[model samples]
Target: MRKSNLIFIFLMLIIATSCDNEEAVSEQSSTEFSSMQDGLITLKSGAIVEKKGDDFYYQSDMLLSQKQLETLNEHGDFIIEEPDQIENETEIHPVYNIPVEANEDGPAVPRAFGLYPTPYNMWAMVRFVYAPNLTADRKNIIQQALQHWEANTNVRFYNATGQPTVDPVYGFEYPYIEFVNATGNSSAVGRIGGRQKIRIAAWQATSVAIHEIGHAIGLRHEQSRYDRDNSININLSNVHPDNRHNFNKYTSNYFAVGSIDYNSVMMYDSDAFAINPAIPVMTKKSDGSTWNGGNVLSNPDRSWANNIYIPYIARSDTYRELAPVVYKPDNTVMTPSERLALQAQLNNGNPNPPNCCRLPNNF
Candidate 1:
């Protein structure tokens, strides 16, 4: 894969946090592998298995002869097993530049509110850690990513007067994209409208930016190990020997009910490091189909801006039109029923939360 693509993969791994813990458990049981598929063996426990060489045993202990063990040890420890898992963590961040009324203020209402008159002709604001230098290759990559979005959709990437120092008058906002001189690890944030923030890393692959952009436009991981039949190609000889013993330590708790796709851009490169032993296979659709061309808006070589909605605004015609409205209650203390009603309203249709104004000190 190209360096840009690799960087994108790393970014995806960084931004994509596993929702559940992956600490390894004591060896519950062991199973022997009888066959290899795509260079990996599948054990009885559903863990993908691999052998380093003729001398290495699939089990943790040195089950092979002394000479064989020495020969295999030179190569690296064998991978006996690994779990099929998917990450479920969600990214969270505060909406920048939006003002909140004091608790003493009256019911908070949105300052400026309304949807764009048109459905698809929306704009997006991208904030980076640093401005892209004119000569930097990243500038091209960023431009490509944006153009990719503009090509198919009716959206446009607007040039703002200044970086997103404060909240916008309207529309969606993203973190500033900075160009770091050194390579290895870089990150980007994909906030779909205002529902959630998805961070993307730059070190692993260039496509990482594109992948996070996909999330920003509402695409989920394709290969969720949670689903059955997810698989990846592996070279047994290249398996990190010492890391083999602790493989189970990285298994995610989430599962997807689907078949696997090996060629997904969402999948990690074979040589990439697995922070936990049970590295997740690239995510896939529940049915196991690879991502079709149109699925992603931006790619490593291109940039595109489009409008995609989360569940809260599913009913709204234009996602860009929904603004956060704050409400402040006159009475400091809200009755239990009122609190429940407020929560229901927020959950049901209103995107903004109710801001409580002044309250009695005792209450």
Candidate 2:
């Protein structure tokens, strides 16, 4: 995984967009439709619409009236606002498309034998762009984040000497980390081979970078809104205007089953001015476990990493049981043990398993 490749993956995940059919609004005479006092109209499906009474509407699969035709022409011959917005004036959820590519080879190897070891001796280069008026102490917050992960995960961080490039390869091997400053409007964290890089928004706080690093290490978003049983109660009629886009996008791939952790460091607290009410508050685990509320990784987070990390790298039988599906194009498929063995060889310096399981590839 070269740095360039890692960046490409991150870009694909965060910036990719897809096209969907826009729902057309049926229009009526000004007399038939009343001017909305709230400046918005709510539709049955929970979509929000800006009322342009008698302004324009799509009819019979095309712009009908001369006024509607003119409005379409003025707007460059396309449906301007999303239909969901018209139906629900309060909040419109944003949709994220996860790229699923077909494996040119065969089905991915099973976790029992196919997992790869994490690159050791590599350094993650961290960089921050703070607001011009940000206090000097604010920068220290990033260091604190690094120290926090290192103390918990046993990884090391290194400082880079010169301007960072979008290099593809990471450190000499694994276990080392690097930090760099990137100039861009996007705030994200990525890993290249052995090195990890984070780009920060100058006006944003450092906590965002810390969260990105967690992504770099293969953690998924904690607030997956897809599971109906996750205990989220969103008010379809009164959603915050700012979070409408993201709220709509929450789904199973990003969220997990039976839980949504609002306190996850990886979650976004605010977008624009409206606070995202859909964000789930962290509750003690079903077993009554608790996590420190600030700046620290919680027990579930740590346990999740512990359970998945080693298998992610080593692909031992135990690790494979943890990750049964190697998501690929066309569908979510099960991985084979042989594939896991190969991956382990590619990743772990020594793919040979301990004396106990010395069969064939040894992994």
Candidate 3:
């Protein structure tokens, strides 16, 4: 075997040996809520989401649709060498809309995925285990990748002795990840309420595992954000026809956080979707540079996480709508006076300002 492979094996054995006595921290959700109920919206990937108090969820878990969350998202992975490795291709993360009755923090301030920061508290404790077929090297790679997330954020992940068939008495809901055999690296974003899978191909396991975990923690690809066009120029003409849809920006739901972060862990490398090897699909505008993607969490990556999972504020009986993630055609939000003016404008188009209550010409 090559020296690098041998050194890797040694490292793997060390990690595995160190984990020999690794105890599983058993737990359950700290927050209290009514029984799980059906949500009003259905996503393109068929994940069902609803609002329980101020938070949104997929059944019992708070998950949003990747397509719809574009209004909010603007945020995975696959094949090692293939150019088609993109979130829409290998994995689909969800994003929930602002609650009909929003929260005090408003819908936009905090809470998105079940990663470093979860709503139950400030940190999402993830308990995970390995598939029987998983080799030691793969295990080492996966655990180390998880450590990167742990080191960077407030979130934490555990290596379970076995699959969590039930909730941890002291931890969050089935907060477990199980490694499985798969073609490419992919992880369902957020907790799916059970044994979530982080599929990794052994060949390029480390980086891919980190990328998938980034998705698991509720982040979308940087290039997929609503404001991505402002920074990177996606060369759709040079992109493969089958992979073109990956370039579409948000139309259904949310807005970008502040600006486009070119070096996010969630962003794609420049040559990722090229039709030909030499044809780059994404290019930067500032200096005509190409997005190569961050091998580790960039400043924006950490800041976005800090912003999404700041502190958990329980849902109140009386909802407080902070800022609207989506705006009505009248360009009005929850302020009382704005609503009254909107009524007048919609009723007879009376006294409408140039900017306010102006629907598009088509509308």
Candidate 4:
């Protein structure tokens, strides 16, 4: 399987870089895997599932800091230590970034939370379930967050297709996200396989949901990029002790994409994890400013998202444009059935089947 992807990638990389300027290609394709000369790495296990290439990531765990994932000749332990059962935990950072330390287990190979080598292919039918008790507005907020990601890049987040009569009361039977109530907002870094979650708190602003969806779509905080030390300063003394690690800087080993994305939605804010507002934890060297780019998707953020997943966005996947707009004229959210129907109308035919290895989702 890796061989075929490598072949396809070689052709695609050549075709994508044939433009007069090679810098454009590098700027666009520099993702965790796309930027590498090494082929993408596929994992053999996830939090609980043993399926090959299925895994999840949290923003604060071991996989967050590598300049790039070297070949997985040495597959480390599951980067994030998930709870024995997600249901047993009230809340968790299930998706945060921390340094990868090579222990007695030999050396640590860089790996993203989960493998999402084909995110764009699975974008149209990304399945998710909101906690039933959520109010209409709260559900709308969640849906709005999904649409925000879709609009910025070539992706979609809609109701799970092919409903089953019996669904698991607690979670889905397949790879899915459960947006349940929790103290603060959190989500798995990527497709963790099987049942995963995005816990939303009542007080979290809509932007928080947007940030969490970034994780679900396989993104880590921009400030935590392994190459971030070159762009900003992370002051540990000002940051609260418990959250000090969050400010850890990646080394010179990391690769950078785009003109340093200082205003990405994935960046931590100026006062993040800091006890004193006077002391800026992350000071931007460009102007000695603290990070403040989390409002909306920055140009670099959108570009990297598309580039990382570009392998799946066929120049011919025009049918995706036909996918129903998640937001209505008045900013209301659309349902999955409505989006499907719109897609059918646009194709004047049947939509594509599960091109990716998506599991059954009756539950």
User: All candidates' TM-scores?
Assistant: 0.32, 0.36, 0.52, 0.54
Give me the candidate number with maximum lDDT: 4
The 10 consecutive residues of candidate 1 with the worst lDDT sum are 110-119
Instruction: List where candidate 4 sits over 4 angstroms from the true fold.
Output: 1-124, 165-172, 249-256, 308-363
Model 2 residue 359 distance off true place after TM-score fit, in angstroms: 35
Whole-structure CA lDDT of model 1: 0.30
Q: Which candidate is the best by TM-score?
A: 4
Between prediction 1 and prediction 4, the one with superior lDDT is: 4
Candidate 3 C-alpha lDDT tens digits along 238-317: 87654565565532222233456656666678998677868788888778777677777765566445333211111222
Error of 4 at 25 (Å): 40
Return whichever of 2 and 3 wins on lDDT.
Answer: 3
User: Could you give candidate 1's per-residue lDDT for residues 1-363 as a string of tens digits?
Assistant: 234323332332333221212123223211122222333443334433335342223222112332222223333322211222213321110111112223333323111111111111111333234343333454445456545544434333343323463456544333333433333222211321212222323333345545544433323333223332324333333456544432232133211112333343333343343444344322233443232322233221121121111111112122222112211111123345543443344344443344433212110
Model 4 scores a TM of 0.54
lDDT by residue (tens digit), candidate 4, 217-307: 6666677665567668777888655465455443221223323466777777877877888788778877896657667766555544543
Q: Could you tell me the lDDT of residue 345 within candidate 4? A: 40
**Candidate lDDT (C-alpha), each:** 0.30, 0.33, 0.46, 0.47
TM-score of decoy 3: 0.52
Model 2 Cα lDDT, one tens digit per residue, 1-363: 334323333332232121112224345533334444433434333433333333322210111233223333445322233323222221111222222122443332101100111221112222222333434443465567666654454233333323243333632333223433434212111222322334343444555545645654434344323432343433434445633433432221121212344455544332212344343233334443333222355443443333222222222242212123332212233257634543443334344444442112110
- Model 4, position 352, has a per-residue lDDT of 59
Q: How far off is residue 346 in model 3, in Å?
A: 46
Query: How many clashes (backbone atoms < 3 Å, residues ≥3 apart in a chain or on different chains) does model 1 have?
Result: 58
Number of the candidate with higher TM-score, 1 or 3: 3
